[model samples]
Target: MTELVGIVLVSHSPELAAGLRSLLGQIGSAAVPVAVAGGTDDSRIGTSYARIAAAVKDADRGAGVLVLPDLGSSVLTARAVLEDHPREGVVIADAPFVEGAVAAAVTAAAGADLTAVLTAATEARHVSKL
Candidate 1:
């Protein structure tokens, strides 16, 4: 089975999540599933957490979930959601948002393991001035 990767974007703003989506599209990896949380109107903490949790849980193949967050609340909500569903293949990385998104998209497109994709995203976060 060719495991499909699931991307969970949890940012302080919806724009960040949207931007990640666009990047993923540009990278041309349509097979990867993406779930987004947080944005301009998503101020309710618990709600965002719930959305993220649902997204992760609903990813079809359940190969793995990679979470990328922007700021404070985004991080907190992602953490809470991940805690609530600590599946073995899930990985929540503290990486730079946009950069990590692109790296993840590219890695996922290449059919890399979820762990490798998350690690690459984490490494991409520190590559340069962003």
Candidate 2:
């Protein structure tokens, strides 16, 4: 069985994470395993590493995980999550939230190789005019 690629969106607001999931869904990735981790209007740190880890394992056929974050906390939190729950046949790419989320989701949906995914994420991160 092919491994389903997983997407973990970490942001200051849960809305952004949900938005990414919704966007990816619109892109026809509803079947793919995607997860959102962050604070909601009333809930903070809505999702835990255990959840993410389970999602990764559930999706880990071999595809990998692409982690997108809103800010530095997201970055640190993501690292912590991955560190706590390590998954084989799974890779977490460090990419900026906005562009990287879209690019990573698209790449993962298409079963793009890890190199391509990471490259796209890297390029997306540094492409801002500012």
Candidate 3:
């Protein structure tokens, strides 16, 4: 089978990222590559460029990588990593954390390419909670 598009979840809180990673497994696809870039190297409540950079590298499985950041520093760090160490086939989705991750994971498990997985993540912003 072809490699699935990998996913990286970035958050200021380690628990938040790990929790969502688990939720993606339950609500999305277990076969999908979901990696977490949460907290600092000291296990504090802040984003880390090093962790995000490593997660992006570790998550890529050749198909591509979709990064979903929670907010604030998480987004900044992800973008900084990209700007400093730009890599092809690695993109950060400007979508909701939980929703985008679930959408991306499920789409990748279905054998979608990087573009399609990205579309699923971006389109997930329109999902109504009502």
Give the top-scoring candidate (TM-score): 3
Pairs in clash, predicted candidate 2: 3-61
- Please give the ranking of all candidate structures by TM-score, highest first, separated by commas: 3, 1, 2
Judge candidate 2 at residue 64 and give its lDDT. Answer: 69
Clashing pairs in 3: none
TM-score of each: 0.84, 0.75, 0.96
Lowest summed-lDDT stretch of 10 residues in model 2?
46-55
For residues 4-71, write the lDDT of model 3, one tens digit per residue: 99999999999999999899888758888889998999989999999999999888989999999999
In angstroms, the error of model 3 at 29 is 1.0
Task: Give lDDT: candidate 3, residue 2.
Answer: 91
lDDT of 2 at 47: 43
lDDT by residue for model 1 (1-130), tens? 5877788888666666767787788778767887777654445432376667776776536678788777787788778877876788887888888888888878887888888889978999678774
Q: Model 2: residues >4 Å from true position, as ranges?
A: 40-42, 45-51, 58-61, 126-130
Better of 2 and 3 by TM-score: 3
Model 3 CA deviation exceeding 4 Å by range: none
Please give the lDDT score at residue 79 for candidate 2. Answer: 75
Clash totals in order: 2, 1, 0
> Candidate 3 has what TM-score?
0.96
Tell how far residue 56 is off in model 3, in angstroms.
0.8
